[model samples]
Target: MTITPETLIAAAQSSKAWPFQEAQRLAKRMPKGKPGGVLFETGYGPSGLPHIGTFQEVLRTTLVRRAYEALTGGAPTRLVAFSDDMDGLRKVPDNVPNRDMLAQHLGKPLSRIPDPFEKFESFAAHNNAMLRDFLDRFGFEYEFVSSSECYNGGKFDTALKGVLSNFQAILDIMLPTLGEERRQTYSPVMPVSPTTGAVLQVPIEVVDAEAGLIRFTDEDGAIVEQSALGGMAKCQWKVDWAMRWVALGVDYEMYGKDLTDSGIQSGKIARVLGGHKPEGLIYELFLDGEGEKISKSKGNGLSIEDWLQYGSEESLGYYIFANPRSAKQLHGGVIPKAVDDYWQFRAALPGQELDKQLGNPVWHLLRANESHAGANAPGSGDTLPVPFSLLLNLVGVLGVGATREAVWSYLGNYVTNADPAAHPALDALVDKALAYNRDFVAPTLAKRAPSGGEVGALQALDAALADADPAISAEDLQTIVYEIGKQPEFGFDNLRNWFKALYETLLGSEQGPRMGSFIALYGIAPTRALIAEALAKA
Candidate 1:
C-alpha cells in the first residue's frame, strides 16, 4: 500500500503499540499557544552506573516521541535526558569503588561529592558522562539536561520561588503521607548547610514568600536565613519532580510502576506550582530470574553489557519494546529467545500491511536509524537465512570454543550465500551465538538414555537417514523425520513427544532448533551417527 500522511495518522490512531497509544494521549493533553512543539523527558538519578532500566526508559520515550511526531506530520519535538545529579548521596552505592570516600560525603548532593572513580570532578559528573556516552553510542537523538546545572545556573530560579509561595499548599499535599515523626520535620524546601556544604534536612519556616527566603538551622547549630531560589535550596523529590515539569515545559515522561504514588503526589504539587503535570506512563518494573524486582544495589538483573554479550543491541531494544506494562524477567537466559524473536520480527515486517507494520517493533526501531547499533546492515533483515537459535544449535554440536570460521564453514554447506564477509549482521550473530553457546548452552549439554519407544524410533530413523540424499533440504529432512514418526511400530503418541525425545536424548535440552534445520546443518551422516549413539546408550 502507498503510505501517505493521512494513512500514517490513521494507522497511528489505531495502532496498539504502546508508544503510539502514549503519543495519542500526549496529543490530547498538550497545551495550546506554545510555539515550541512537545518536549519529552526521561529523568535519571545519577546514583549508580546507568543500567538496562535506564536504557529502556530512554528508548521507550524516544519511541513515543517518534510516534507523536509521525502522528502530527513531523511536528517539532525535543527529548531531554534529564539527570538528577543534585540529589543527596544518602549512602554509598555497593557497586561503586571508594566506598569509604563516598561514605564520608554522605548527605551531600551527588554533584558535590568527590568522584569515587576519580575520573570526573564529582561523583555525579562521572555518572552523567557515562550516561551520555551510553546514549550517544546508540545514536539516540536527545539533549542532556543536568539538575545541578539547571539549579546553579538559575534555570530553576523562577520555579524555586514558585515553590516557596506554594509551600503550605505542598505541605498540605505531602504531610498526610508522612509518618508522624517525619511529618513534624518535613519541609518542601531543603536548604544547603552554609558551613557543612551538605543538604540540610531540618525543619524550616517560610520567611517571605515574595522574597523567596526561608529560615532554617544549619548542621553547625546556627540559625540561617537563605533564599529558597537560586540553588540555595531544593525541594524534596516529589516537589522537585513537579518543579522540573513546570520549569522545563515537559509534555511527556514515563516512570516505573513503583513510582505511581510519587507521580500522583507530584502531579498535585505541579498544579500547586501553577503548572500542569506532564502526560506520563507508569510501566511495570523488570524482575530478575528469581521473580524479585531488579535492583542496582543488589546487582540482580542483566546489565546492558550482559545482554549485548549474547545478543544484538537491537534485540535488547526489541525486548524492551515488546511489553512495557507487563513485568519481564531480565536475565541471561532470556537472551537467545529475544535475539531470535527480534530477527523474526524484522523478517516478517516486509510481508505485513501498513497498520501491522506500524505496530511491529522493528518498524519503530528502524524509524530513527535503520542501521543503528550495527544491526540490519546491508544484506540483512529478511535476507538472513538462519535464525539465531539454529546457529546456536549448530555451535552446540560443533562444541564449545568453536571458532567463527568453523561455524561459517559449516553454515556455507547448508546455504550457498552464507559468507561472513558479505553478511555482517549474520557475522555478528555468529559471534553472539558462539558466546551464548559457550557460556550458557555448553555447560548443560548431556545425552540422556532414550526410552524403549524412542530407541525403536531412533533405530528406524537411522536406517531412513542412511538411504536419504546428502543434499536434501532442511524441509525435506524434516519431512523424512515426520514420516518415520508416523509409522505404527514406532509407538510415538505425538510429534511433540518424538521431538522431546530427540532433544533430551540427542541434543541434551528440553527444546531445540528444528530437527530438519539441525540435520541439514550438521550433515546427514553426523545426524545418523547421533541417532546410533543414542541407540547405543539405550
Candidate 2:
C-alpha cells in the first residue's frame, strides 16, 4: 500500500503511461553513485490567460515528484516550470480587456505586453506570477525559469553550439516532417521569417571562464557576428526543445497527448545533439462538461482561480491525482464531487488498505488536515451542506439573505448529515468551508427581487407569527408555525409554494433546502420581518 518510487515506476511501466523503454535506456546512461533524480518540467506559452490545463500540468508534475520522493526514500527532485515569454505573440487572445494594445504588441516578445493588472511590467510576468501563486496554493515547490532570462543569461551557449553542429541532422529529421518549402525556411537552430523569407540572424561571440568576451563567426559559415553574451542559444520551437532539455539537465517531463508527435521529434533531436534522452510521459487532454477542449482563445476554458473559488483544495488535488494517465477528457464541474467521494471512500476503507489505495498525494492531503485541524479558530466553523449549486438553490428557496456560515450550518446539519459530535473531523471540514467562502465564494445568491403577491403572503405569515405568543423553546415555535401553515387557505403546500415563489423572485431558482427546517434554524422573527419589509416595499 505504501507507494515507493520503484512501485510507481513499475506501475507506470505496466500502464504504459510513460516511455518505459526510453527510460530504461536513459537509466543505463546515468552516472554511477549519483542516483538519478526525477525532474518534471511544464512549459507555459504566455500568450493568454493561464487556464485549468496549465494547472493540470503542474499538479500532475507535483504528484509525480511526490511519488518519486516516496520511492527514492526522500531523495531530492527538481520541479521546474518554464515560461516561454520570449516568443512573439502569434495572435491576440479574445476577451483581453486591452485587445487593441495587445494587438499592437503582436509579433513582439510577450515580455513587452503591458501588464493588464499593472502589478507586473509585462503580460508574461503577470501570468507567470499568477501561475506561481496558483502552484503555491497547491503546496508545490518549483524553480521558475523565463525564456527571456535564460536566453539573455547565456545559459544556452553550449547547447546552442551543439545544435549548430547537429544542424544537418535536424534538417534531415525536420525536412521529412515538413514540406520542402518549410524545410528551406529553417536554419540550423533558428527559423527564417515565414512571410519575408529573410534569414533571421543572431549576434554571437565566445567568452572565457573569467567572463572575457570574443566575437565569433557563424558555425554554418554565415557572416553573422555578435558579442559573447549574445551568443546564447535561440532556436526554433523544436530545436529549442532539444537544447532546453540538455541545458537544464531535465531527466523527465510529461506532455499533453496533442504534443506527442512534437515530443517524439524533440527526443530525436536530443539524441542527435548527444545529450541524455529525458523520460517522457503523455497525459490525456482535459475537456469541459460539453466535451470540448478547454481553450482560452475560444473563451471556452476555466481558470484555476475560478475553480478554487467554487471548489475545495482537496477536490482540486483529487482531480489532478486520481484520474487515469491515459488520453481522455475530464468534466470540470464533477471535480469537487469526485474529491468528496474520494474522501468518503478513504474514510470507509480500512486504514492500511486505504493508505495503500489513495497513495502518497492523498496521504499528504490527509496529513495537511491533521497538521492544521487543531489550530482552527472559533467562529470560523461553517460549510455548505451539499455542492455549491445546491447551496445556491437553498439560498434561493429560504427567501432570507444567508451568509456562508448559515449555508455551512445547514449542510452539516442536514445534507451531508455530518454529525459534529460523532465526527469531530467535520469541524475542520466546516472551518475549511468558511475559509473558502470568505476568500473565494462569489455573491451569486441575490439574483431576483420579491414580487408583490409573494411579499403579501410573507407579511401575512409574519403578522400571524408576531401576534402569537413568543415561545421559549424552538420546538414550541415550530409547532405554532406548522399549525398556522395547516390552515385550509394557507396550507403547508401553499405556504411552501409561496416560499418557493419568493426564492424564484429573489434568486431566479426553483429548488432549495426544506422550507420549514430552514425557517426554524434561521429564526422565525427575522424571517417574518424580512417578508414584511419586502411587502412594504411592494
Q: Which is the leading candidate under lDDT? A: 1
Tens-digit lDDT track of model 2 for 150-233: 866777766766766666678788768876666555554442233322224433333331342333344354554333233233
Model 1 CA lDDT for position 152: 90
Among all candidates shown, the one with the greatest TM-score: 1
Cα error of candidate 1 at position 2, Å: 2.9
Ten-residue stretch with the least lDDT total in model 1: 370-379
True-structure RMSD, every candidate: 2.1, 9.2
Encode model 1's per-residue lDDT on 240-354: one tens digit a residue.
Answer: 9999999999889999999999999999999999999888788999999999999877889888998989999989989999879999999888988888888888887877888
Quote the positional error of residue 69 for candidate 2 in Å.
1.2
Question: Which residue segments of model 1 deviate by more than 4 Å?
Answer: 31-33, 368-380
CA lDDT scores, all candidates in order: 0.86, 0.57
